[model samples]
Structure formats: C-alpha cells, structure tokens
Target: MNEHLKVLCSLTPCFYIKREDQASIIGGVIEFIKELQQFVQSLESKKQRKSLSPSPGPSPRAPFQLSTPQTENPKELGARCNSPFADVEAKLSGSNVILTTISRRIPAQIVKIINVLEKLSFEILHLNITSMEDTVLYSFVIKIGLECQLSVEELALEAQQSFCSDAVYVNDI
Candidate 1:
C-alpha cells in the first residue's frame, strides 16, 4: 500500500487494505505488522489530487481588435444667420428630428413647449436643457411617428406660438 493511501484510509474509515492469506503467510505475522507500520509512517505527507482528463487546446482564431478612427467634421466659418433665436439649429433626419433653441427664458417655458409638441403629435425621445446667464434653452431629439405629415416650418411656428406668445400667428415663422 502506498504511504498516501494508508493515511487516506486512516482519515477516512471507508478504505481498508485486504489481507492476502498467501502473502501474509510468506511474510509472517511480525513482518506484515512492520510493513503496515511503514505504510502508516509514509502517509504523514498530504496526497495531491490527480486530474482524470487532459487540458483543452488553444483556440485557432485570434481575438478581435477594434480600431475606431478619431476624427471630426470641419468647422464651418461665416456669420450664422442672426436672429433672436440665432443659436437654434433644427434638422430632420429620417423618423427622428433634433431641435435646439437658445433663449433667455426657456426653463420657464419647457412644459408649455412640450405640451404643444404633444398636441401636434410629435413623440419626444430625449430633451436636454442648457443655460447662459439667466437664459436657459432646450434641445429635443424627437421621433416623429409614421403618421406624422406636418412640415418642419409649420411645426417650428407652432412651437413659437405655443411657447413664445399666446397669439397664434399663421403664415409666419
């Protein structure tokens, strides 16, 4: 019996060394006792667990390395069309639209503005508010539904009327 096996047997009562009658007879009782004693002494060291299965091989393909380019659109020069809302930039992209307005009083006007857009059947996706020295403006990136058919100019005018004044001014933007 291996020394590690002997210790494992003593610690765990489930294991036992079977006595072979012919081998025990040849060794004699005293020799058999000495062999068992040697086995117990060898078991003082710990037994290492062995794995039954072999390790897996490395993968064939290399991992993906994503390289994103760092670039920016060229900044355009020239005085932007000047108006009281000169900072506003509105654009329609597919089903989505972005409306940016620069104003001094937008914070106090957001709720009314959104209500007007809702009335016009525009569905807002996101709204961002920004400010400068007592004036706050908002940018809304909206998803206009498939059923929407109003012109951007008309919508802008409606928004102006909804937030800027009580009087609805048609045919003007």
Candidate 2:
C-alpha cells in the first residue's frame, strides 16, 4: 500500500496529489479544484461589477467647475438677466462666432440655447458639450450670414439674459 501510494504521489500527470495517504488524495484534489473555481468566479464577478458601475469620479470630458456662492440661489439668478457673477465672452471674426458657456446643469437648457441661436440666424458649425454632477459646459462655433445684424457681444448678452443664472458663463474663442 505504501509503495502504491508513492507511485500515485509520483505520477507526473497528477501533480496535485502531493499526499501519500491514498484515502485522502481524491478529497484533496476535489477541494483544490473547488477552491480554484471559486477564486475564478470571484474574479469574474469583480470584473462584471466594474463594467456595470457608473463612473466613480468626474468624467474625463468635464471641462470646468461651476461654483456658485452658498448664499445665492441659482434659481433666482435664472429668473433675471445679467447676473453680476455671470461671465460671458463673444468673439466675432467676419461672419463666424465662437461661443463657450459653463453653467449649472439645467434640463432642456441646451435646446433653449439652440433655439435662441437659430432665432438669431446663426448656423451651427460645431458643438461640444460635457456635464459633471451638477454643471454643464458647452462650446459652439457658428456662422452668421452677411445679412444677420447681431454682433458677438449682443449674442453673448442675449445668452446671459436668457439663462438668467449667475452660474452661466459665456465666452468666445
């Protein structure tokens, strides 16, 4: 029995059977395989969890921070035009205008801004948008026809007037 156990232990194909006890060999192999399977399953589960999770931190696309004073309500700013804290910039070169805005995240805000631009007869050339938890940033390049009379400053003022939030910042580049 001892010699047989040694032969079984020495078997190259069954390297897992390190013990010399014949009765416990199968049980040990079964236990080892089960442990291996469990470890693999845990690894797979971790991968799946990571893939399914939403971003744990700020998105890479977020461009800037939207900081508002704690004492002021964003909604109040939204009700009025030309917030003192609002920052706006507009650049016009020939018939092209470049505008960028950062503001608190408001639902349908982009649609409203697009509507304003269209009303002013600006043709959208390029648009880029990104959002963090509570803020949104937009960059737009637009072409105004020769017939359109709105200047870059006028357009920037209009956006500030429409958004009515101190958090809104519009700039041209």
Candidate 3:
C-alpha cells in the first residue's frame, strides 16, 4: 500500500468528521426535503381544488377579453370605450363578486370606481389595493343585493359608460 493510504487507514479518530455531526447535518437535510415535499403537495392540492370548481355563471368569457354583446344598443359601449386599465375583470366568488382592476396609479379613478359600485347597489365588503412600480391593482369584494336584476354585462357597460361620460379629453378613461 502507498504511504498516504497507510496513514489514512491508521489516522486518529479526531482527524475525521464526528459521526454525530454528520448525522445532524443529514437529519437537517432530510427535514428540509420533507418540508419541500409538503409545499409541493400543497400547491398541487390547490390546482386540484381549482379544477374541481363549479361551472361558471351565464356570462363567463375570457378573463381579460370582454364578450361581444348579442345586441348593439346605442347607449352601451361594449368594447369601443378606451379604458385606462391594463386589465379589468370580475368573477363570482362564493356569495360575493370580486372586481379586479389594474391600471396606472390614478387616485381619482378609484373614487369613480367606488361611486360606480355604490350606484349599482353593490355593498362593498372588502378592498385590497396593491401597487407595483407605475401600476396599481384594486380588488373589491362586493355583495350583490337579492333585489338587483343587473347582469354582468350591465355592470360592465354601466361602469364603462361612467368613465366615457366623465372623460373630456381623448387621453382620459
């Protein structure tokens, strides 16, 4: 055998890592792996839950794109209105409706949105606002009254008209 091999074979126990330290490190790694596995499982379960959700309402369309109106009423600005929002979407969640509006930070526009909601007989349950760089997101959880007969299309058209009427310049929304 080589001289280095002989020395390694006969080295004192302290020359190598302690078994306890090795076990501790291995245990920590195992624990981290287990935690990572649990996190993945949680994400998968969330996807499963989303897939199993109920069929959508009568007027479900693409989230970002508005559906074409069956009839063209002179009063309604279905898709012609120039909106400032990067995205405007609404969905029914449980007993409330969630309206998500993404736009550049326009403080006055928020008040207009709130007024629109109040005018529609929607009770605002919660509002979540998030700002990122130049854009801001507004999420409103609104409860529709049982007596209300307005459809999703009506709500959208009314909101759009409100903006269109208020806008004096071409750049306004």
Candidate that scores best on TM-score: 3
Model 2, residue 26: displacement in angstroms?
68
Question: What would the TM-scores of all predictions be?
Answer: 0.44, 0.45, 0.48
**Residue-wise C-alpha lDDT for candidate 2, range 20-111, written one tens digit per residue:** 46666765555345434533453454446447768663232323222321212233221112232223445543346656565556677788
Give the residue spans of candidate 1 off by over 4 A: 1-88, 167-173
Cα-lDDT of candidate 3: 0.53
* Candidate 1 residue lDDT tens string, 10-90: 442221123434343333444334424433332221111013224332121322222221213223111111133223334
Candidate 2 positional error at 31, Å: 62
Model 3 poorest 10 in a row by lDDT: 56-65
lDDT of 3 by residue, 1-173 (tens): 35543343343222122233545444444533443453345345444644775643111222234663332334422231114333454555446665656555655777888888887889888786766565565667689887767766566655555443443553343
Q: Rank the candidates by lDDT, best first.
A: 2, 3, 1
Q: What lDDT would each prediction earn against the true structure? A: 0.47, 0.53, 0.53
Q: Is candidate 1 or candidate 3 better by TM-score?
A: 3
In TM-score terms, candidate 1 sits at 0.44
Query: RMSD per prediction, one decimal?
Result: 34.8, 25.3, 21.1
Please give the range of 10 consecutive residues that has the lowest summed lDDT in model 2. 76-85
Q: Pick the candidate with the highest lDDT.
A: 2
Error of 3 at 172 (Å): 12
- The count of residue-pair clashes in candidate 1 stands at 1
